[model samples]
Target chain A: MSSKIRIEDARRFRVGDGFRLSDVDPTATPGFSGSDKDLKKELVQHDEEIGVLQEKLHAEKQNSLLIIAQGMDTSGKGGLIKRLLDPMSPLGYRVQPFGRPTEEEAAHDFLWRVERALPKPGEVVCFDRSHYEDVLVQKVDALAPAEEIERRYGAIVEFEQQLAERNIMLIKVMLHISKDFQKENLRDRLQNPEKLWKFDPSDLNARAEWDEYMDAYQIALERTSTETAPWYCIPGDNKDYARAVVKHLVVDALRTIDPQYPTPDFDPKAELATLESMD
Target chain B: MSSKIRIEDARRFRVGDGFRLSDVDPTATPGFSGSDKDLKKELVQHDEEIGVLQEKLHAEKQNSLLIIAQGMDTSGKGGLIKRLLDPMSPLGYRVQPFGRPTEEEAAHDFLWRVERALPKPGEVVCFDRSHYEDVLVQKVDALAPAEEIERRYGAIVEFEQQLAERNIMLIKVMLHISKDFQKENLRDRLQNPEKLWKFDPSDLNARAEWDEYMDAYQIALERTSTETAPWYCIPGDNKDYARAVVKHLVVDALRTIDPQYPTPDFDPKAELATLESMD
Candidate 1:
């Protein structure tokens, strides 16, 4: 609630008809007019609120949340999750990061593994990378035949619609970053001994096809960003601002759900009386 | 480690020959010779070390950790987890809380669901309550045949050994709390609207058979605490002290594993060169 970005204004970042990935400036901090230091303080406040809302969500045990975070390598998906969910109780949430599928996973439909990982009632799960990859990476890399890839767009829309029907709210976020920003991040990983473990050679292959990946992402967004589970595109070059925007989206969704503590089934006075009466 | 309880002294809390449930003082804060304020500061320091070691564990991807928290109702299993794990990145950890089995879970062998929830390599999972319940609650409530309950102890020991052989380090913890402490906690939950959702009528039933459950826990600890997976009993009347001991135990295990940031498999210079040369 302390956010400078109103829920209505944050809607500007949502993917829509004719949405152009290149039109958004990754470095610009829209809606937030404060200094970085101020944003940090505001984030702490927002996290505290997220913590409370998450507890109510857990206590209600009637609905679940699935937050799908998709982006190119080094686009800050992991960083965004840490800022967004660490302040909340770990008991009420999970972070499931999808990697290149195992042999068993690759053998099934693209959504098989994803369906198994959806949040149970009263839980919030963040997907560090998700089924969106089946379309984005699968399409750009030609891992699947063109005809099969074309069919996946409708398959994904229907899959998400089923989740919405099941009372599982979906927050789909695409952390949009420029190619130059990713090169800087990859270089930082290569140069820092502490970060060297994160630098994978495969990342270079992905980087080489950045433009194609962008095109694939644009197509996926256009096809799948429906009214039920629309996608939000956050400019990720400024980690703080992007993280703040994600916090707003999660808070707004939780606010809409407005989970409340369930009313106790037994009378407290009677239960206390019975407890004391026990020998 | 900043812990006043040296790992050897902490071993004193382990169950072994002539271990008696009644002998241990649930209110004593042994090993820790600090004020509550000092313990609070020490816990923060320990959590920072946990955060760093956990990342290394994730990077290495050769080992995993399973922390099992078991205690009487209202002994602060959830609170201990919030303190011990929330400071770390949510990406690297999961909290799996086992409630009374559903129809499907009840139909399977007791360990079936737990087997499915074990941590993967490079991950840390906390079982808020776990397979130990099969022996504790099943024995107390006579949920299964006496002979069947008798078989579970051996089954559990063998199961944990399998985990240890697979490089999944297990930290089994029992939060020892006085009955009086539990009574106060339940009263607090009943009195507070915010916490009312957590108060269950069945908890009173368990409390009524306190002596029986204590006997059950003692028997389970004696039978199942092995070299591979030892149970650490922390005094729970003082929550801060209990949480600090659990943090130290986890930190010590991670230190023993001593996971390292993996060396890059590819030549970094050549990869960088190739990356730069790509069109």
Candidate 2:
């Protein structure tokens, strides 16, 4: 496993014009050329590096990070998040899961709750399901007026830009799992007693209209992927490879930020003497 | 490394009537006859077990947990919290660090802010510092009126009882460190460039009045340690042992809760068939 995995052209995974979901293979591990053992070894190293960067980010208390993970059910969003943050100290980052809105949340504008959940300076926050749900599920199920949904694209772009200006870097990930993979995952949930609690009968309703959801995601990805807050469409069938790619994305973001420990105002030698002299 | 390290007498570390801070040795590792290698192996196993229990707790969505870690500066509160929650999913638990009160926070009652940060059902919340700050720092520094500080003790008892009734189990741990140990830690912070950012000049002020803080903690522990929420004074000089004991304390609480995966309300066989038959 190389120390540098050629993240130079990571943008090749970004969504652009005519970015059809069908064009990308869900099973592909684009840049990584490693066995399963190698991938595991690489991930351990990534975890350690990410951990160190996260501490520097915390110590600097200047920039912040927000990773929004949007995926269809059983796309391994939960597992991906676990692995991405496996080595991080719990204090430095937080995971925010967005489910169906409650009455209060529903009453407010779509961005209202999201704005409230934005990361503070020095914090790394992950959104399991984020504002993209408005475009994906809402558009697919026709939960809102089509015109209202159309207006949200520009609103999202502006919102993300504002976040970037505030030094809150955003990594929007679309975990692209094939329909067959989702079926297999749902099957596992149904068959495994330990995992049965995760099975929801309503999950089938979304599966019934898979193509429409795909179209919705494609549109959202094209509209939302910008230089500041770009969306990385990760191949999700191979869980290990997908997690490794996401880890790289995070490490790359932190590296770009280049957070450093703040220089102390007080003299270190004098403080040491003062501390040592204390009764 | 036995499967069950006898936690039957875990309360031996708890503060009770006639409790004194000086009595318990900071270096003692009671009931643990393991070598350093054994402790490391045992921790890995504990991590896995805690992961399973945490999942069950999240699945059941019935009970919640609150672990409060209060210790003097340089006593390893931050490190202890990291190890305690290392294995849990970020979504299932939150680490809330309570620093000096902000203007808005100071305007509200002490418990007001704490109540807002409490874990919901099925979640685990850890407080690096907590409402105890009101009793500890407030009492030692005479920040509040004497009568007001005296009244907070009974209020905390009632507050904790209310939490217990709501099934939010609380584990309050005071990481007991000797003054000599703290001096060594502060000296390291001053010498190590990577650690210099953590060295605050005012940390020595707290060290200067160490005995006052200890007296304050002793009083607070005796008053607040009840059947519902007990304070565990763990020896902190041995960081590994302190962390292991805290892990056992958490694992024991989860075991007591015994949160089981919810029995599927929908028939699994039927759901499996339904999912399989879907287009």
Candidate 3:
């Protein structure tokens, strides 16, 4: 029998902090020994703040927030979003899964396709895989050149700035899973039938050049983290710790928004007959 | 023999078109009329646009839209959203069913609770019965005075303006089902198990004073319609016609959005390598 539950429990704190070298199981290198108590405490405040901001934003009907997540083949983007947004009100939240560009999409400029999915005000939209693929995969596949990638990073800044100027919040997340952790993730997918579809053979090819992709991501982080749209590199070896961090970031962002109620309209009188009748 | 299909079709429309007219046969409303040829042609264009938006938005990976339907008790909100958004992308979109306001909501401003449900930017949110209920129900029960209703209307306008400022497109639908049509709707609901949940004997109380609600709605439309958001009074008697109008509105909105793809980045060596590999 496998020690799955123990490993699962250990997976929660295997990042940020240094893990005990002696306890490192043969399955994969453990990250850090973290305290769930700390993680739980941190998440409570964040969850509350998000709740308030969500309500305020909806009521104010003000700026909407869009979150875009991108990372390596097994970077845990899906897991990150799930944990980060679980506490949000289901009514105003949306999660969009990205896939291959369609024929119509191919006809338009890369950003054209994205512009159409912009959320209405007072909503939160999360991109599982964003336009970064144009740079990430295109460069990996030689579909695009460095000049194009450089241009996109700078252009992204402008695009994001415009949204910020108009009050649409933009947040980007990159799940940083180590090569060793990724292999474990791949193993999980392979062994489990339920997760089999998630594993694409192409992902194996991509994993081979992991270091090159890391360089690309490093450049992406440095070039794209702007005042308008900031990027957070989350540690993914420890799922719980990662969730804790993401939770904090989202709540912090929402609380900082501090939306207010639209001004009240009805007065105490004028319809005196009606008010009296309800009583 | 009862015409179930006609009743089903009628449920798809906005309220108040055929009910006030002379006696209704109650049996002849089912078949899809070929007379609406021009409208059908327009719907095809709308359908094409929708497909384009669905593709483009999916690629962009930015945000989602929520459409909320809100109206008088017998309003056809549920039917409209179900048919309109069903085929698009259910994963990226959501429909929230709001029951009576909670005590917490009543304690705050009328818009307080609703604020929690607004969609994020670049999203479409439809309200079945939104904050307007404060004006509608309050007016009906004499719970709130005229001054209060006017004030709430202003709040709604400000709230919508803020939503537009952010990116969420707002569409408020007031399904204007007539008194007789409402009776038929109630009868159908009671007769069908699937629809019984929608029926409430209390809905009959307001039916006695249909003109009062009409006047209230007219005031709502007059006060709340703005450039940021517009109020459409859909005719509920004819189901297909109503669906057509809604489909037209959605298509019109998406056309205005005209989403695009993000620019890509590239490297010359990488590009050359990819091209050489492909060759």
Candidate 4:
């Protein structure tokens, strides 16, 4: 019955032709309706299901999954990763948080660090802030020339297509929080003693150009979201609702993968007897 | 009082100035003496301490940690990581397992991938197999010319020193197991149907050249173990003991870092009052 939750409706959040970030209300939970308690209970069930699906994926050892989380600071990327993916077996799941490029990373092409962090077969990898940073921050800040920024969008499409061809499923999510929501989150961080360490004064510089960033995200989502790797702009002002939607989407993807326990190539009865006889 | 445990003595297992892999007993627990129950309990305490230290490290947002785990097949690198590091916060730690080089990776210098995988500040990263693979497997297989192999030794020393200067603490560990122990482990894998996915026939090829691999490790350790990054040859025959030793070493390094709860730049009382006043 939970399978009937229709997570595919999340595609409604997908960027399509002429998609605008301004059109969507960050406070809207597009598909589901439940009290906070009910939503959390549902998330627990999804977690268990995801855990089981991951074990199957690990056992099958064929396909891989890559989930990319992109958003502005305080958009809840860390919270989503901690709550959703961290509970899974670390053997088969990895979380790669991309931050400021090191001098060494800067020397290489933009995608090199991203390519290096890719999931191996049967592994699920989440990118906290990913290659999208190049297009977003780099574009808004004019770190790269306009021409180069355009070129990267094409490059991302090709890179993601290659991954899909190699049996890697790609899920790109942008946590869509309103400018007002961001202000509240930033203010909360500034006013919490325990959270002060996470507060970077430089974030205000980004906030000053909020409109430019939204424009950058709009253009990026339009250009890079392809059949192989579609981008979803999840409404993130309601953190709990956003988390629920993400859980459903991930569950739906795993269900589509539907990995089964691998059949043993060798005779199981003989191996079991041998194992039994071993000292 | 547990801090009195000297994890540095793990260096007793170090491949010193004039060391031979043949000199060490793989079955021996060099610096620890405890029952399995006691070891597990101790590991739990260390895990809790590690959790606390990692929180401080994250809060401080300064120095980084890079832990390299190198071992032959069935030496329990995966097991050690799952048992020890996986329980910690995924927010501040990463596990990278390097397998055979891809065509793209092979295009770059040996250290290119290693450089890419280095930890950012306030993060702890573990490499399941690392650049040492270039020296170990590549040397044994004669994949590189003799001159190039010699050059990598110097490159590694310089590279590690640079990392040290950059404030990355490097802990290099070699899970040491005897050839006889490896045979038993391989047999166990072969006889276990559930673990068949992990059984790779190519591992047999590597096993055939065990002596050459040992020689390669000996030369590598002798060449690269410096004050900044030291190699500890952890006994792998008793998986529990190796894990305990690793836990102690990691805890000791974290204790040395001694990252404190960062002081708030703003007045906590005023901020708390402001936060309470907000809707």
Which candidate wins on DockQ?
Answer: 2
Q: Write the per-residue lDDT of candidate 4 for residues B1-279, one digit (tens) a residue.
A: 123235665657766688777887899875566677766775666777888788788888788788889998999998888776755677888888798999999999999998988998898888889999999999999999999999999999999999988889888999999888987887777766556666666677788788899999889998998887889888899887888788878888888888876886656556545444543
Candidate 4 local Cα displacement, residue B186, angstroms: 1.8
Pairs that collide, model 2: none
In angstroms, how far off is A105's CA in candidate 4?
9.9
Please give me the DockQ of candidate 2 compared with the native complex. Answer: 0.83
Candidate 1 residue pairs in clash (backbone atoms < 3 Å)? none
lDDT of 1 by residue, B1-279 (tens): 233655566667888778888899999988777677787876676767788999999999999999999999999999998897866778888999999999999999999999999999999999999988999998999988999999999999999999989999999999999999998898888889899899999999999999999999999999998988888877889998888778878888999999999988888788777766764
Residue-level lDDT of model 3, residues A1-279, one tens digit each, is 112123244324222233322232322323334466654554454566676677667656687888887877767677667555655555566777677788998787777767777766888888889787776777777767778777888777777788887788887876677767777676675555444445566666787677677767666666767656777665666666656556656665676787775543432232223323431
Q: What is model 1's native contact fraction?
A: 0.79
List where candidate 3 sits over 4 angstroms from the true fold: A1-33, A37-41, A265-279, B1-93, B96-279
**Fnat for the candidates in order:** 0.79, 0.87, 0.07, 0.36
List, for all models, the DockQ compared with the true complex: 0.75, 0.83, 0.06, 0.23
TM-score of 1: 0.96
Model 1, which residues run further than 4 Å from truth? A1-3, B1-9
Model 2 regions lying over 4 Å from their true place: A1-5, B1-5
Window of ten residues with lowest summed lDDT in model 3 chain A:
A1-10
Q: Model 1: per-residue lDDT, tens digit, A1-279?
A: 333766665688999988998898888888787777877875666677788889999999989889999999999999988888866788899999999999999999999999999999999999999999999888989999999999999999999999998989999999999888988888888778789898898899899899999999899999999999999998989888888788888898999889999988889998988877775
